[model samples]
Target: MSENELIERIKDRNPNEPEFLQAVEEVISSVSKVLKKHPEYHQLRILERMAEPERLISFRVNWLDDEGNVQVNRGFRVQMNSALGPYKGGLRFHPSVNQSILKFLAFEQIFKNALTGLPLGGGKGGSDFNPKGKSDNEIMRFCQAFMSELFRHIGHFTDVPAGDIGVGSREIGYMFGAYKKLQNDFTGVLTGKGPKWGGSAIRPEATGYGLVYFAENMLKSVDKEIKGKSCIVSGAGNVAQFTLEKLIQLGAKPVTVSDSGGFIYDEDGIDEEKLEHIKHIKNVSRGRISEYTEKYSNAEYTEVNSDDDFNPLWQTKAECVFPCATQNEINEKDAKHLTDNKIILLAEGANMPCTAEAIDVLQESKVLYSPGKASNAGGVGVSGLEMTQNRMGVYWTREEVDEKLKGIMKRIHDDCLETVETYELSDHNYMEAANIHGFLKVAEAMKAQGVV
Candidate 1:
């Protein structure tokens, strides 16, 4: 089938889903060259099912606040294709939760899980209610209400949900409590549980650690390494902190970590003391990152807003860049600045951090740009680990789990390089390699299963 014909068929089937359509189009474009080797996929047109999900679940989450006032929020779970394994992904509970965002995440999870060589499918669930200012009791009540419905759709062997964004250990604990209450069972239906409740020890840091592992693998593809290189990482959340920790362990200096308000630049280097303080402030105390400056003079925190100048970090050259924050955080301007400084490697710790234009700029400059799916699969990959431990009624040691995760990420990195070589693409075309590698697996699965 021609590329235009495949896109038209996808649009005709999923017209209302603009985000889903765009994701499908991008994957098709990346793998169109490789599709010639597999004429069976074109004959079956498995790309159509790849465009639409098997099921989309939308429901209402009604609960009571601390004042006994009723609050209502919309909850969603898009169970994207599960051809490879059971449904697996994180549950993001932010005000930005919607059908479009969940669709894109779930769609991406399908391929992310596939790349891991795990027996897990793709699914994402979340609510639109923000847990920022809510009291503990209020958050518990809301989670209970949300899980009242979600528990019926998820299970240990079927679908497993982990923490994402606003959802953390507290939220996961509450949701798990509610699920146990509803199902009257103690199975590990959800991941990221408290250790006392069957959670993995290093689950929180898996994504960041996996990202660095993938980065190291990508660096090795060019006969280079991350040791002694300076890394600029955004987001002070789980991904950022762990990425910093791993970089520090590997003898790399990470000088930046950001939040929604702004970012901090520490030219002197981010030590363990500073990292511990940031974790306490953001995770335990739930405070802003601007307070980091109050503790250390060398570390300056500035609000990343329209008027704020971004030159401090951008102008300071770095060998590697990891955007662990939200999507679209780095645009064309940011990409140009990094490329101009001779930044050799770029990997996304968050989903789709680099915009399409920014990615284009990176490829033009021949920077090793690894997409989030391949770079940040550690989170979901470890989530799958949690599921495995749960099913076997056995938990692996932190070292054991981390070893498996590193191996998986290394394989993914090598696979990306092998894919580029097979397709005769450029050295820096990580996106194409990742997209095609992930697409071919799911596409072949869809073909074997036949059109639904």
Candidate 2:
């Protein structure tokens, strides 16, 4: 079928799912030329199956709050494409949970997992249940209720879920405990388990570290280097903190870190002592970014009031930018600022943090732009590694897992380069390159396995 025909078919099948359709259309546009090279896939009707997920599971999660009142939230798991291996992705637990967002994430995971060269398929499950302000018992009860149904559809060799957004180690523990009770087995059904359990040592830092590793490859392609470059990173959570740490170790100087409330700028760079304080406060104490400024007089924390500009911290000049925050954090205006400041590298640590308009602006200016699918695949890549260790019943040391993650990131970089060269595209547009590279792998697997 023609491109237009395929798109029309997709629209007819899922008329209201614009979010999922947008992602599918973008991937199709990037590799349409290559698909023309192989008419067999088209003859086999691959696009029909590729456009929709193989399975989508939705259910209700009911729990009792500390007030002895019943609370309910909707849950979902979109097992997109699993021809490569078992379905694997994170489970997010936030108020914003819905079919549109989960479909976008699960669609992205299909390519991200393939890029890791791990035998993991793509899937994502989460609930609209908000854990914030809930007591420990309340959160545990919600997780158990969510997993009671989810456990039936998942397994170690079938589907393995990690954590994302509001779903942290604590939530994973609750879900895993419930799964064990339902299945009556102690299996590695999830990847982001605590170290005391079957979780890998490097899973926490993999995404952030992998991002810098991918960026390093982008730098090398242009005969540039990461050493001594200034970086402005958004988000102080797991992905941001680890990306900053890895960038510093690789000789990049990160000077800014932000949270939901505001960002803190440290001209002297964030030292270990300061990072420890930030982590202790954010992770352990659950305090706001303002506390960091209170303890350290030199650091400046800007209040991100609703009326304030979205990216108040972008006024500062920097050579590199890493937006590790939520979706659409970097707008078109912010893209212009980075370009005006002569930012050489802009790598996304969060999924689609750059709006389509912002991305177009960056592409027009010719700055090296690495999308999150490839740059932030490190977290899921490490989860795949954890699955491997679990299957083998052998846990690796932190250093060993980090080494493997570095290797995978290097390979992802090389794959992007190869795709760019093959298409005669510019090196800066690694987004298209990564998308095509990831797509072809899953496509080939689907072709080999036949339609499910």
Candidate 3:
């Protein structure tokens, strides 16, 4: 079947799964040229099989709250593909966790892992149990219960899960403890463990750091540098915090940072000291971005206005824009705002943070755009490094891990550029290059394995 036909079939099969279908359509459409060149992939129904998960494990997670009330939540693990190697991805724990979201993330993971040049395949698992507002004990109980059923399907050599969104060091610690107790063996079944417990030194910061590395490469391609570029970074979470750090390290003036509450615009730039304060506010105090204005009198904090069609966070005047927040945070209006403000570079630190219409606007404006799968693959790349370190039973120094990560990010950037030139695409379509190049690796592996 044709790519469009395959997408239509996917839509029909996955009703109400807009996220999943969107992901499949993006990849299928991006790699249409390669699919046409190699019709064997069509004959073997490669896209059809690739769109479907190998295993979809769903269960009810029951745990007691601090009030002694039994809370039940839906949990899911979508082992999307394992043709490259073992299944590897993060497990998110947010109220937004659903089959559609997980499937889309898993599908994106396939290409992301392939781009990393790692043996890891793609999979993602999570529960709809919001860790927010929950007591430590309650959160521990929930993680333990979530792992009770999840442990049966995951392992170091099978499916290695990490942390995402609401799942951080605390949550990973809880889940790792439960998995250890359940299996009665110590192994690297998880990647975001504490450093003393086998986690890599830079695992938490890899994604954000790698994003800056990718962005730097993009700027260099245009004969520009990040040193004096003004940047607006959304989301004050791990990705945003570290992205700011790296940007500052490169002498870039990152002027804004945001959370769900809204964004803070500091014209003086967010230096290392400001970033540290933000880390404490979000990671320790669990406070809102508005608290930033109290510390820095020059900064302005804007609250999220639901009636606004465009996110004010993206409207900030800047040369570089990094969307490190949740999916679809940047709508078409926001994209137009960024373009009107003369934004030169935009890269996603979060998965699919920009809507399709937003991406079109950026592309039409000739802005250098990098998709999350390639730009944010650093987190998973370091996770893959953590797996190697685990297998060797040794830890590398911080400098070593960071160096390796920089090399990987540079290689991925070059590969995407090469793919774009090879495909003769206009406007340096990194999204299409990333999708096609990433898909080719996995597709070859699947074909060699004889359609398993």
Candidate 4:
């Protein structure tokens, strides 16, 4: 069947899975022609097989709140593919957690992990329990309850899960501890552990630092440099924080960072000192991004009004932007805003942060764009390194791990550029190159493994 027909079938099957369909459509739109070039793929029904998950696990999480009341939340794990190796991905805990969202994330993970060139497959798990305002005890209870079921499914060489979105070191620790308690055995069943334990160095900052490293390579390709450039970075989480930190380390002036509450645009660039404040606020206090204005008089905080068609954060003039906030945060209007403001590049730090329409706007405007699969593969790259360290019972220094991550990002960037050259595509068409290159490995592996 044709790629469009396969997409229509997917939509018909997953009628409510908009995010998963969007992800599949984005990838199929880029790689469909490439798939057509290999008739065996169509004959073997590879596209149809890939569109479906190998395993989709869902469970109910029950925990008690501090107020002596029982609370229940839904948890999920979408083991999308294991063509290359063990199932590897993240566990996100948020109010928006659902089967469709996890499936989208897991599907994206399959390609993102492929781009990293690591022996890891793709999977994602999460729950709808929001940890934003919950106390440590409440969060711990929820994590234990969630892990009690998840433990039965994951293993070191089977499925090594990590953190994402609402899942951080704290949540990972809680879940790992619970798993260890239940199994009565210690293994590398999870990544993103604390440094004192099995976690690798620079794991927390890998995604953000790798993003900058990838961005630098892309900029250099077009005879542009990041030094002295003004940048807009969205999201105040781990990825955004480290993106800001790395930009500062490289002498770039990052002017904005945002959270769900809103965005903060500091006319004065966010320096190391201000970043410390932000880390304390979000990591310690769990406060909103708007609290930034309370300490820094020079910073202006804008509350996000849902009624607005476009986010004002992207309107700020800058040489580049990183939308690390979440998926679909940048709509077509937001992309248009950046293009109109003369934005030079956009590297995604979050999965599928840009919609299809937004991508079209940016590409038409000739903006340098790299998708999350290639740009945000750093986190998984480091997680892969951590798994290695755990297996060998050895740990690498921070500088060693960072160097490895840099090399991985550079390799992914070069892979995209080479694919562009091979396909005779546009100079900066990293999206097509990335989707094609990433999908090639998984497709071949699936073909080799036969019609399972």
Alpha-carbon RMSD to native, per candidate: 1.9, 1.8, 0.9, 0.9
Task: Evaluate all candidate structures by whole-model CA lDDT and list the values in order.
Answer: 0.86, 0.86, 0.93, 0.93
Write model 3 residue lDDT over 108-142, tens digit each, in one string.
99999999998999999899988888889999999
User: What ranges in model 1 sit over 4 Å off?
Assistant: 8-22, 306-316
Stretches > 4 Å off in candidate 3: none
Tell me the number of clashing residue pairs for each predicted model. Answer: 3, 0, 0, 0
> Which residue pairs collide in model 1, if any?
85-121, 86-121, 262-304
Residues 1-452, candidate 2, lDDT per residue (tens digit)? 88888888887877777567766776777778667888877887776676678899999888888888988899999998898899999999888788877887888899999999999899988999887777789989999999989999999889999999888889989999999999999999988899888889978888899999888988988999999999999988889888888887887788898888888988888777778888888888777877888888888888777564447777668999999988778878878888889998899999878877788889988999988889999999999888888889999999899899989999998888888888877755788998888988988988888756
- Write the residue-wise lDDT of candidate 4 on 59-78 in tens digits: 98899999999999999988
Question: For residue 421, what is the lDDT in candidate 2?
Answer: 88
User: Lowest-scoring 10 consecutive residues by lDDT in candidate 3?
Assistant: 306-315
| True-vs-predicted CA distance for residue 152, candidate 1, Å | 1.5
Local accuracy of candidate 1 as per-residue lDDT tens digits, 44-153? 86666676778888999999998889999999888888888778988998997788778878988888888998888888889899999999999999999999998888
**Model 1 accuracy (lDDT, Cα):** 0.86
Clashing pairs in 3: none
Lowest lDDT block of 10, candidate 4: 28-37
